[model samples]
Target: MSTHSRTARSGDRAASALAYGVVGLGLAFLAIPLAITCLMALDARTFLGPLPPPALSLHWFERLASRADILSSLRTSLVLAVLTTILSVSIGTAAAVGLARGDFPGKATLTSAFLSPLIVPPVVIGFGLLLFLSKAGITNGMARLLLGHVIVTVPYCIRTSLASLLGADKRLTEAAMILGATERQAFWSITIPLMKTGIITGAIFAFAISMDDVSISLFLSDPSATTLPVTLVSNMRAAFDLTIAAAAVILMAVTVLLIVVLDRLVGFDNVVGQGLFRS
Candidate 1:
C-alpha cells in the first residue's frame, strides 16, 4: 500500500480507539455510585456519612436480621411486588396481545392511552392517585400503594409484552383456526406460549418497578404500612449506618436475581431482538 493510504488507515484506527476509550470512561462513571453503595454495605460503621467507607465489618448484617421493622418492610415489599407483577403483567399482556393482533376501532388511541402512565412524572401520578383514592374514601394504606405500583408497572408490561406479541408468529393463530381449533384453544395452545418470553420479561419489569419505586411510593406510605424503599428513606432521615447499607445491598441483590432468573427463563437476547422490532 502507498504511504499516504497506510497513514490514513492508522489515523482512522486511532480515532476509533479514542471513541471506545471515551465510551468506556462514561460507563465507569455511571457505575461508580453502585460500587460505592456495595462497599458501604460491607462497612461496619458507614451509612450516610461519606462516600468512602472508613471501616469494614459485618455487624450491620446481623443487625438487619434483628430489626423487626426491617423484616416487616421486606415482607411488605415482597407482597406488594408480587401482587404488582401479577396484576400489571396480566393486564399489560392482554392489552399487548390486543394491540398487536386484534383489530378494533380506536386501537391506536387505546394503545397510546395505556402507555401514558410511563410518560407522566411519578410525583404527578402519586399526587393524583392520592387525591383520587382519598375522594373515593380509601386513603393512606396498602391499597393506595398497590394502585400506584400498578400504574407504574403496567407500562413496562405493555412495552415488553407488545414486542413479544409482534415478534411472535403472526400467522400461527390463523393457522390453528384453519385446522378447526376454536379461537380460545388456538390462543391457549399457540399464541400464549409463543409470547411467553415477552410476558415473562414484562413480569420482571413489573417486579423491579414495584420494588424500586420511591417517588410514587413515598406519597402513599403510612406509619402502619411502608414498603422497603419508603422504610429505607425514613431510616436514612432518622439515622444512617451499616444497617441501611445492608438493606440497600439486599435490595440490589434481589433485583439482580430477578433479572438473572428472567433472562434464564427466556433468552434475554431474543427479547432484545423482539423489542427492537416494535420500535
Candidate 2:
C-alpha cells in the first residue's frame, strides 16, 4: 500500500481501539458494583464493608428466607406488579390505538397528558396520589397501591404500544376490511398480532417498574401492605446486614432472569430501540 493509505488505515484502527476501550470501561463501571454486592451477599460475614469476607457461606440467604416480613412483602410486590402490568397494558394499548390512528383535535395534548407520569417526579406523583386517595376516602392499602402502580406503569405501555402501532403497515388492516372483516375483527386478527412484541415489551416494562418502585409504593403502602422495595428500605434503616445484601442479590437475579426472557422472546435491542426509533 502507499504510505498515505497505510497512515489512514493505522489512524482508523487506533480510533476503533479507543472506541472499544471506552465501551469496555462503561460496561465495567456498571457491572462492578453489582458483582461486589452479589459477592458480599454470599460472604459469611454478618456486617457490610468494602473488604470481602474470609470465606463464603449461605447464612445470609438462610436468614432472608426465614424472614416472614420480607416474604410477605415480596408476595405483595409480585401481586401488585402482575396487576399493574395487566391494567397498564390494556388501557395503554387502547389509548395508543386511538392516538396512532385517530384524527382528532388535541391529539398531541392528550398524548402528552397520558405520558406525563413518566416525566413527573415519582415523589410528586406519589404525594399527589396519596392526597387524592385520602380525599376520596380510599383507605385500603392494596387498592391504593394498585391504583398508584397502574398510573405509573401506563406511560411505558402507551409509549411502546404507540411506537408499534405507528410502525405497523396501515394497509394490513385496510386489506382485512376489504376482505369482509369487520373493524373489530381486523383489529383483533391483524393489528394486535402484529403489535404483540411491543405489547409484551410494554408489559415487561410495567412489571419491572412496579416491582422496583419505592416512592409511590411507600406513599400507598401501609404496614400490612408493604412492598419488597419498601420493606428493604425499612430494614436498611433499622439495621445494616448481609440479609439485605442477600435480598438484593435475589432481586437482581429476578431482574436478570426477566431480561433474559425478554431477550429470548423478542430481543432486547428490538424492543428498546425499535419502540423508540419506529415512532
Candidate 3:
C-alpha cells in the first residue's frame, strides 16, 4: 500500500481508539458511584468506609422491614406512580389523537401548551401547583401529589403518543372507514392497536418519572403522608446511615427491573426510538 494510504489508516485507528477510551471513561464516571453505593449497602460495618468491605451482610436490607416510615413511604410512592401513569397516559393519548387527527385554530399553540411542562423548571411547577391547589381548596397531600405528577409526566406521554399517531399508516384507518366501519370503530380496532407500543412506552416513562420525582413531591407531600424520595431526603437531614444506601440500591433495582420488563414485552430499541424522540 502507498505510504499516504497507510498513514490515513493509522490515523483512523488512532481516532477510533480515542473515541472508545472517551466512552469508557464516561461510563465509568457514571457507574463508579453506583458501584460504591451498592457496596456500601452490603458492608457490615457500622460506618461508611473504604471500598471492597472487609465483611458483607444483608443487615441493612433486613432492617428495612422494621423501618415503618420507609415501608409506608415506599408503598405511597408505588401507588402514586401507578396512578400517575394511568392518568397521564389517558389524558395524553386523547390529546395526542386530537392534535394529530384534527385541524383547528391555535393547534400549534395547543400542542406547545401540552408540552410546556417539560420546558418549565420542576421547582417552579411545584411551587405554582402548591399555591394554585391550596387556593382551590384541594389540600389533600396525595391528591396534590397526583395532580402535580400527572402534569409533569403527561408531557412525556403526549410526546410519545403523538409520535406514534403521526407515524401510523393513515391508510389503514381510512380503509376501515371505507369498509363500513364507523370512525369510532376504526379508532378502537385499528388506530389504538397501532398505537399500543407508544402507549406502553409512554406508560413506562410516566411510571419511572413519577417514582423518581422528588422536587415536586417535596413541595406537595404532607407531613403525615410522604413518598419514598421525600422520606429519604428527610431522613438524610435528620440522620444518615447504610440503610439509606440499601434503599437507594433497592430503588435502582426497581428501575432496572422496569427496563428489563419493557425490553421483554417491547423491544428496548423500538421503545427508545418511539418514546424518546428519535422517531
TM-score of 3: 0.95
CA shift of 37, model 1, Å? 2.0
Taking every candidate in turn, the Cα RMSD to the unseen true structure, in Å, is 2.3, 2.1, 1.8
Quote each prediction's TM-score.
0.91, 0.92, 0.95
- Each candidate's lDDT (Cα)? 0.85, 0.91, 0.91
Q: Per-residue CA lDDT of candidate 2, range 1-279, in tens?
A: 999999999999999999999999999999999999889998976677667678899999999999999999999999999999999999999998999899999999999999999989999999999999999999999999999999999999998888888888889999999999999999999999877887988999999999999999989999879999999999899987888889889989889988998898879787767544475
Error of 1 at 95 (Å): 0.8
* Per-residue accuracy of model 3 over 1-279 as CA lDDT, tens digit each: 999999999999999999999999999999999999999999998887877899999999888778999999999999999999999999999999999889999999999999999999999999999999989999899999999999999999998888878877779999999999999999999999877877988999899999999999999999766999999899899998888999999999989988987788767777666443433
Q: Locate the minimum summed-lDDT window of 10 residues in model 3.
A: 270-279
Local error of candidate 1 at residue 229 (angstroms): 0.6
lDDT of 3: 0.91
Off by over 4 Å in 1: 1-7, 45-55, 274-279
Candidate 1 structure quality by residue, lDDT tens digits, 1-279: 999999999999999999999999999997887788788777766345665667777777899889999899889988999999999988988888888887899988998899998899999999999888888999658889988999889988888878777766778899999999999999899989977877888898899888899999888888777988888888889876668878888888888899789778987777776454553
